[model samples]
Target: MNAPLDGVVVLDLTRALSGPYCTMLLADLGADVIKVESPAGDSSRRTGPFPQDDAEHLYGGYFQSVNRNKRSVVVDFRSPEGIAAVRRLAAGADVLIENFRAGVMDRMGLSYESLQRDNPRLVYGALRGFGDPRTGASPHVDRPAFDVVVQAMGGLMGITGPPHLPTKVGPGIGDLFPASLLAVGVLAALTDRERTGRGRFVDVAMYDAIVSLCERVVYQHSYNQAVPTGDGNDHPLLCPFGLYRTADGWVTIAAPRDHQWQALAKTLGRPGLGDDPRFATNNARVVVRDQVRAVIEDWTSALPTAEVVDALSAQVPCGPVNSAADIYADPHLRIRDMLVELEQPGSADPVTVAGQPIKFAGAETRAYRRAPLLGEHTAEVLGADAPPTTDR
Candidate 1:
């Protein structure tokens, strides 16, 4: 069966997490992605969490997670011959993606404007800390940024944890979210190119993406002139919509609506609380959130985590605070094929990585190919007689 993007070709010049993640999504959707790397290869090859028994440690798990389903070709861009080869590849590709600092591509003479001379219909996508100068430039355009930097500067950390204690999220949404948005922009640009026969420049900034993700705080600060503070696990807008303690562990319950609240109250053997004026409506409950929380915890404290979930499962939206181990053992994940096993190079055991989240009705859902070895496809792609030093 043909995939959604079977005929589209992508020249991927991204390293690290953000750029690679964007290309990975395209590759998963059946785009012919050719990962262009330097002679030293992607820096992620050295990043770890290596297997215990693997002596070679060829590629670490971090690299494997986001780089599957793509071919790698090494090119020494410092040389004229290498630069010529890259231009040739870009001429045939439908899309090109990069995550370098703002001016690095221009310095290397591989800027979108230069490449468009060869392929006018090519869609160019860039993910950066601030943004590319082709779009709108910022004073901090030259500064380097990572996931944590944007999370803090974009207002996510300010409202994440307990009061007075800012916390970074466990996952690196700072990088991944921007990459996801860039993928959308690339697709949109590709669609527009088909209509106009002209490609466009698309860029996403990590800071801008995180700020968009935290838009609630933006509206609150603008409308009420109030600075939002952390309220631990509870939500500011909805009561009974946060983590709760059970006898053995933690569970989350969201009973903000009237029917759900009434069902929860009855399930806890306190149906009268549903009608009590102090806690009857969501607004009233928010005014006395402490009392509402205490009342719920008093009943849940006497029950184990499983019992609490079982009792409220049909009545309210509730689930346990799962750890990694719990998630690995979850039957729902197995049924949905969310955990995929892949054979890593030089390792006898298979490594498990996350599966693609987006699903299509008839399309294959998993990455069929594994991440490539450094420059493994270099000679085949550049032609066998190209140059010896070109295929590091």
Candidate 2:
């Protein structure tokens, strides 16, 4: 079935996560995304914590996670012929995405200015570290950044963990966050083009995107002069909003609303505690959060996490903290089609991967194809009309 972006052509010059992820979303919606890789290939292909059976092709789980529904073209960007080929491809493309460091595209003569000169209506998207051309020079411009650096620098790590230690999230949200933001910019540009018949240049810096993610901390710092400290699974402003140990495992309970707090107190058979001077109001409960949590834990620890979750959910608000295994076994996830399986190129059987999160009623957004092998579509993308290649 033809999807929303059926005829849109994207020249993907991005590597690793951010740019590829942006293009992947477009590809999933039926855009023809042609990923242009260097001779060495995307570094993520080799850097993965891979599955045990196949190690030769660098077909790691990490690379597969974000690059489905697109074709790849391995090109030596340094080669004159290859650069010419890319220019030719860009001429007919609707979007061009890249995550090279500041000035890398300009140095290679493939900047937005150069590409737009050839294709005036092309949507140019760039993903960068702290030092984008728009942000001028940064000390870390030359420094290679991963999710960790962006999280640490963008104040995410500063407020992420407990008061004693700052921790980064397990997933590579730094790259993916910017990727999502860049996707928004690309779509917005496309929408604007619909009105004006002109595409626009867009950029998403990892630092800036992470900053947007943690604007609450910035607001507290600015307005309240509060240097936020991590609350160790508990919310600083909300009482009894944290993980509590159950007989079998852990569960999360949150009662921000006064009505919910009253409901929780009644559910725990401690209704009088809700009206107590130190825990009567949300503000009071927040001030004496530890005492309130201790009282709730006393009631919760007697039951298993699932039992506690069931009891609390029936009365107020609570949920069991599910492990990865628990998540995989979850009936709701299966029912919603959140987990899907696809066969890897050259693999014997299908392997489980994440499915598209959005479900537009009229859109055909199925993951019909698997992630492409490196240079798998070099010939197909350039068209069967072009010259054939013997190179593997």
What's the count of clashing pairs in each model shown?
Answer: 0, 0
**Which candidate tops TM-score?**
1
Residue-by-residue lDDT tens digits, candidate 1, 1-392: 67888999999999999999999999988898999988888999989888888778778999999998899998887877777888899999999999999989888888888999989999999999999877888888999999999999999999999987999999999999999999999999999998999889999999999999999999999999989978899988898899889889888999998888999999989999889888788988888889989989999888999899999988899999999999999998977778988888888888998888777786555546788998888888878534444444
- Please give the lDDT score at residue 334 for candidate 1: 78
How accurate locally is residue 32 in candidate 1, as Cα lDDT from 0 to 100? 86
Model 1 accuracy (lDDT, Cα):
0.90
The segments of candidate 2 whose C-alpha lies over 4 angstroms from its true place after superposition are 55-58, 135-140, 362-365, 384-392
Give each model a TM-score: 0.96, 0.93
Error of 1 at 127 (Å): 0.2
lDDT tens per residue, model 2, 113-189 = 88889988999898888746654666677667888899988888888788958889878889889899898899999
